[model samples]
Target: MVQTFLPHPPGARLALEDATRARTGSPVQMGLDELGTPLSQTTFVVVDLETTGGSPTSSEITEIGAVKVRGGEVLGEFQTLVDPGSPVPPMITVLTGITDAMLVGAPRIGEVLPAFLEFAQLGAGTVLVAHNAPFDVGFLRAAADRMSLPWPRVQVVDTVKLARRVVTRDEAPNNKLGTLAALFGATVTPDHRALHDARATVDVLHALLARMGPLGVTHLEDLVTASDPVPHQRRRKSHLAEHLPGGPGVYQFLGPRREVLYVGTAVDIRRRVRSYFTAAEKRRRIGEMVDLAEEVRAVPCTTALEASVRELRLIAEHDPPYNRRSRRPERRPWVRLTDEAFPRLTIVRQVTPDDDAIGPFSSRRAAEECVEAIQEAFALRRCTPRLPRLARAGASACVLAEIGRCGAPCTGAQDVPSYAVVAGAVRACLREDAEPVVAAVHARIATLAVQERFEEAAVQRDRLRSFLVAARRTQRLRPLWRCPELVAARRAADGGWELVLARYGRLAGTCLVPRGVDPMPAVEALVATGEVVAAPTTAMGAASSEETELLADWIEDPATRLVRWDESDTPLACPVRGAARHAVPARG
Candidate 1:
C-alpha cells in the first residue's frame, strides 16, 4: 500500500494507507491553492554533475546525470560524459573516477549540453534539483554562456540546503548527500559518480518533502522557500498571508482574542505579509507578535497614500502594542506664542486659531530647543511668569537682562512698545520670514567660533538646526491647514491617476482613476462624497500633526499636481524660504 500524508498540525497522524494514490501523493490543501502548484503534481529533475575543477570559470564539466521524477515515479533519465578539451588532472580522476581514457571518446559540452537542456526542461512545471545546486548549475550556466547558448530559466532547489533545514545534526552527522542518503536509507548510495548521486538525491528529496508536510508546505511555491532559516512555528502561519491581495493595502495581525496585535502598510499586501514568516523579518518584537497572531486581515486600497493613511488611522485606533510609532498623535507637542502681555514662547499640547504657533514638534525637548533658538536670536524674555501691564515700583530685572538675552520690560527699562520690536521680529521669524533670525544666529555662531568657544558654538548650531527643522515642518503644513478644501492628483504606479481630496489638512477621500479613463468624473465624485471637514480650531486643523505631515510630504512630491484650491485667500505656498538655504556653514 502506498503511504499518504495529510496536511495536519504537529503531533497528528503523519501517514495513511492509500493504495490508489501515487507513492508521494498527499491530500493537501492550502489557502493559496489557486496560485501555487501542488507538490504532489510537481515535476522535479534531480541532477548531478562531475567537473574538472571547483570553480566554474576555471573548470569544465566532465559528466551530467539527471533523473526526472513526478509523484515519486521515475519518468526518464539523462546520462552523458563530455570531453574537457584538456587532459584530466590526476586529483580529479582520483576523486570522480573519470579518467582521460573515459573522456577521450565522449562528446564535447557544446554537443552534450543541448541534449541535457532538452531533457531537463521537459515542459512547464519542471524544476531542477541537485545536492549542491549552485555548484552544478553554475557550471551549466557558465558553459552555456561560453557556448553562446541561451540558458533556460528553471527553478533550482539544492538538496544540501534542504537537508540542512530538515535533517538535524542528531539525525545525520552532516548535510552531505552521503550522510543524508545513509540516514534516509536510500536504495541507491551516493558514490562519486553523477548518476548514482542523482538517484540518491531523489530519495532524499521525497523524505524531506514528507517532513515538510506537517509544516504546511504542501504547495510548490512554499516548498521552494522552505529552505529559509525561518522557524517551523512561524512557517506554519504563512497560510495566513496566502489570501491577502497582491496590491497596496494595510494589513492587521489579529491575536487569538481577535484584538489587533499590529498594523502596517505595504505596496503588495501578500508579499509583505509573507515576508514576516521568512528569515527577512528580523524584528524580534514583531516575531513575538506573529507567534501569538491567529489571523491576518487585509484592507485593500487603490493607492499607496490611501494605504498609508489607513495604516496611521488603524494604529491610532487600536494602539497595538507592537506599533511604537504614530500611536499617540494626541501627545505630539507644538510651540506656540502664549497669549500674554509679554508673548513668550511656550510648548503646548493644543493650539488655538489666534495663537501664533510654529510647530507640532516631534517631542517636548525638540519644542523647547526651538524656543531656545528663537529666544537666543531675539531679546525675548525668558521668565515664565506673566508680567503686569505696568511694572511695579522697585521691581528688579531678571538676570536675562544683564546677559543681553531679554529686553527687561519688567523693570520698566524697556516699555511694552520698545519690547514689541523684539517680539515683532520673533513673530516674523516664526510665521513669515526666518532669514533675519537665521542670519542673527549665524552671526553669533561665527563670533563664538572666532573666539574658539567651539562647544558653545556647537550648542548654538544645534539650537539653530532644531529651529529650522521645526520652521520647515510648520511652514509646509500651515498653508494646508488654512485651506478649506483642496484636490490633488498624482500618477499612480499602475498607470492611473490617484486623486486625493483634502479638507482642513486631513485626507477626506481618495480614489484611483483607471488608465485610459477620464479622471475629471472621479475627481468630481470624490469631492462630492468626501468627508465634510469643519473649520479647524487649531493650527493642526482637523487632523493630527503626523497625519498633516504625511499629507504635506505627499503634496510636495514632484509628481503631485494641484487640481483645485478652494480658498483663494490661503494660497498654497510657503512664504518663508526653505531652511536648506540657510544651513550653517561648518567651522574649520
Candidate 2:
C-alpha cells in the first residue's frame, strides 16, 4: 500500500519556493532562466534496493522500495520483495534481515518490475533518485535486460553526489545515506528495509533542495548537475547567456569595454555559452576570462561549417587576448622563391601574386627547416646578393663553390643557363612536382645510414618530412585558391542537405535544406546571394591560410558532392601523395 506525507505545512514556503513555482511551466523551454522544470515541480522517485551481491552480473535483487514526491508532498510509494530463484546468502540475509524462508512465496523480478516501473512513472518526465544510484539502477537495468523488458530512458539523481556537494565534511562525516539522513533530521530511521530507507531519502532530498537555492540551483537541471559546483561569481554572470539563440553560431565574450576576450563556435550557442560559467569549463585561463566578461554576443549561422569559418575569421580579426590559435595570420611565415637572376628559396612573412610559394608554415623556424631541406636536395644558389643577369667579369664565388653545394654563378663559373636549370627545379618542386626533391632527400638518407651516420640520416629525414608536409598542404590549397567559385552539397546528420558556396577558398555562404524539401532551390538561392569573392591577387588567396584550410577540409570530405566547379586553369586535385613512406631513415 502507498503512504503519503507533506514535508512542508500549507503556506509555509522557503526562500525561492514561490518564485520557483511561478516560473515552473514547460521543461522544454530553452531560456537560461527557464532551465528545465523548476525543482519545486519536478517529480522525484527516491529508490533503494536490497541485493544478493555487489555486482549486477552476479547479484539479484531481493527487494525494491521507492517514494515518489513533488513539492515536498508524497505522491505514492512502491515496495516489493523478489524471489532470487536461489537461496539468499547468509551474509546478505544478516545485513538486511531477509532469510531464505522469507522468499518462499514472493513474486519473481519479472512480475514485480512492471508494477514498480508504473509507480515510478519514468516515461512521463519523472526523475529517479537514489542514494548510490549506479548500484540500484544497475541491478534493475540488468534484470530488465535479462527479461527482455524495455527500459525507458529516465534522468537519475544521486543523493550521495548531491550531499557531498552541499553537506560539508564538518556537518557530516561522509555522504553516506545514513549519515545524511541523520544530518537532515529524517523522520524515518533506516534499518536496511527498502521502504524504510527510501522514506529516509525523501527527507534528505527535500533538505538538500532547500540548501541549493543560494547556490543558484533553482531548476531541476541545475540540481542534477549540482555535484559540479559553480562559483558564485561565475553563476551571477549566467544571465549574459540568456539572450543568446539556441542554434549553430559563433559567440564572443566581451570585456567591460566591449572588447572581444574570447571567440568560440558551437552547435547550440545558448547551452555552450552557459557551460563557460559552470564546471564544464575547466581551463584556468577561460575561467579568468569569464570573470572579466561583461556580456556575450552571438552571430547565428545556418550550419556548423559556417560557424567554424566565422569563428576562425573572428579570431583573426580580433586577436582576442584569450584565443591562442589563428590569431595572427599576418605573422605566419611562408617559403617562397625570390625573383632574381638566380632565384633562391627565402622565408618571407607575406606572399604575392607573382611569387611561387610553398608555405604558411607554422613558424619561421619551420619555414627555415623546409628551406634547408630544399637546399639539401638541389644545387640552388645560397648567396643573398642578387647577381647580374650576365655574369660579371670580376665576380668571385664564395666557399660554397669550393664545397660544390652551390652552382657558383657569382664566380662566372656557372653560366645563366646552367643556373636556370637549378632554379627551375626548385620552382617545380615548390609549385608542381615534389617527387624529385623527395627522391633526392630519400637517397641521401639511405646513403648516410649505409655509412653508419645515423644522426645525419635522421636530420635529412626530418628536413624531407618538413618539406613534404608543407608541399602537400600547398598542393592541396592551391587548387582551391585558384578556382573562381565552387558549390557543393552533402547530406547532413539530420537527413537534410548542407549546401555551401566557396569562392577563392573562402566560405561565401551556406544553407541547410530541410529533410523532405528539394535542395535545388536552396542551392540556387545560396549561389545567387553569396559573397562575391574576387580573384585573389596573392598566392595566400582572399582568405587567410587557416581559413582556406578549414574550407579545404570540408571540400575534401568523401560524403560531400561537388555540384559545380568554375576552374581557373588548374583542376581541384593533389598531384603528389604524401611522403610518409620516405620520411623514415633506413636502419643499418
Candidate 3:
C-alpha cells in the first residue's frame, strides 16, 4: 500500500477537477494543479522543486515540495526528498543540503510519485504556483518522462514573471527566491532547504499577486504557469536542432490550418527557419514574431532571387495575417545625377537613360560634391547666370571660375577648356561603375598621405565614401544572391509563361516559371529603354506579368547569367536565370 500522511479525498465539485485528474492519471506527468475558473472555487496548489542540477534533461529532481492554499489560506502540504537514482552533485549538496547520505534510504521518485500525484489530484483545480513555473514544470515533465509518462495539460503561475509586470520590470532589488521572499515579507528567515524554497516561492507569489490589483493577477486559472520554469536553454525540450531545408523559400506559421499567422523568407531556408526557435529574447523583433507562431511551413525555390521574387509573390497571394507591410506594387525613389556645363545637382522622380543631371544622392553632402566636382573638372562658373548689373562682366570670375574652380568661365576665359572640364566631372559622376572612382580616390588619398595633408586626406576619404554611395545605390538595393537577367515571358503554346535565360545578350536557354513566385506582380517596361523592370502590375486583375522564374534554371551555371539593363552599368551577380550578356551586332 502507498504510504501517505493523510487520507484520500473525493474530487471537488468544480469542472477543472478533470484537468487535475488528467495530469495525475496520465501515469507520469510533469505536475498537478487545481482546476476550475477563479470565480468558481478558486484555490491554489502552490508548488516548487529542488533539483540535483540546473538542467532538467541532464539533471534529476532531488525533491518535490508542494502545499495547498484555499480562500487565501494554507490548507495542507506534501513535501518529499526523492532519490534521483544518481549521486547529488557537490554544488547541489552545498546549495540544497541534500546529499547521497541523506537520500540513501529515501524512496526513489518512481516509488513516491504516485502518492504525491494522488494528493495533488485530491485538491484538483489548485492553481500551481512557483517563483518561475517553468523550473518546477520542467522537472515534473522530466520525472514523467523518466517513467515513460506523458505531460499533462496543467496550468501554472510564475512569480518571477508576475514580479516583472505586477511590480515593475526593474524596480525589484532582486528577483531571486530570498529577494522575492523579503520583498513579499514572506521570509521567516532565509534558508536553503527544499521546503524553505517552496514556502518562500508561495510567499513571493502571495505578496506579488496581492499587489497586482487591477493589473489582473487575481484569478488562479486565468494565470499562465508551468510546473517547469527553469527549462533548458534550447528551443526543443530535448535540445535537438530544428532541422530545416537549404533552398530559396517562403515560410509561414500556422495556428491550426485556418489561421495563417506569420510569413518570412530565407535563401538558405533551414537556417532562417531554425532561427525562429533559437533566437533569444535579446533579439526582440524575432522573439516576438516566434511567440505568435505555432507551426512552420516552407515553399522551395531553386535560386535566391527566385526565392525573393516568390517570397513577395506569396505574401500578396496569401496575405498571411502576421505580415505588417503592404504587399501590393508601389513606387520607391532612386537617386540620379545630371550632367551640365557646370554640373548642377538635382533630384529626379524616376531614372531613365536620357537623364544625366547631377545626383540621385540620398545623402545631401554627396550632391554638393557633385557640383564641386563639375566645377573642379571643367573650370565652370559657379555664380548665377543672372548676376547683378552693378558688377562688371570682366571684374572677376564667378565664385568657382574666379577661385581657379574653372579656367575663368565667368569672363569666358578658357571657356572651351572649362566646359571640357565640366564635361569630364559630369561624366565621372554619371559612371555607375565604382572601381575607377575607388582607384582614383585611393591614389589621391595616398598622395595626400605623402604630403602630410591629413585634413585633405580626410576630405578625400569622405569623397571616396560619396563615390561608393553613388556606385552602390542600385547594387545595395538588389540582393547579391539573385542571379543575372531572367526574362519571364508568355510562351507560344498553352498561353502560360516560361522564364528564359539571356546569356550576355541573346536568349539561349529557358525554364518553366513556377506559379506565384514573382515579387513584382505587375509587368513594367522602363520608359526610355523599353527594358522590363520587375514591378507589380497596376492594371486590375493582371497576373504579375514579368516572368519571375526565367532565371531559376541557369542560376547555378557559370556561363549563362549576364547584365542587360540598357541604361544602367551596374554589374549584377545572379545565380543563373538573371540578366546575362552575350555578344551582339556591333553598334554603328
* Top lDDT prediction, candidate number: 1
Scored by TM-score, the top model is 1
Model 1 C-alpha RMSD vs. true structure (Å) is 9.2
lDDT of 2 by residue, 1-588 (tens): 111111122366332213223333334356544354677888999999998999989989999999999999999989989999988899998899999898889999999998998788796568899989999999999999998999998988898888877788899889887898889899998888899999999999899988877776776656656777667777767767765677787889889888889999999988798888778889999999999999887776667888888789789878899998988987888999988877888889888866888888887877887898888878888878888877878888888788989878887788888888988888877877777778788789889999999889888877776787788778878878888889998898888888878888888887777788888777777777777788888887788888888888898899999999987577987765433223433323
Best-first order by lDDT: 1, 2, 3
lDDT digits (tens) for residues 222-330 of candidate 3 = 3442112222222331111122345455666655543666667787665556545432234555555555555565555434444555556566656766676434322
- In candidate 2, where is summed lDDT lowest over 10 consecutive residues? 1-10
Better of 2 and 3 by TM-score: 2
lDDT of 1 by residue, 241-292 (tens): 8766677878899898888899999998887888888778888999999999
Model 1 TM-score is 0.86
Off by over 4 Å in 1: 1-38, 41-45, 67-78, 105-128, 141-156, 447-456, 493-495, 576-588
Clash totals, every prediction: 0, 0, 63
The whole-model lDDT of each prediction reads 0.82, 0.81, 0.50
The TM-score obtained by model 3 is 0.41
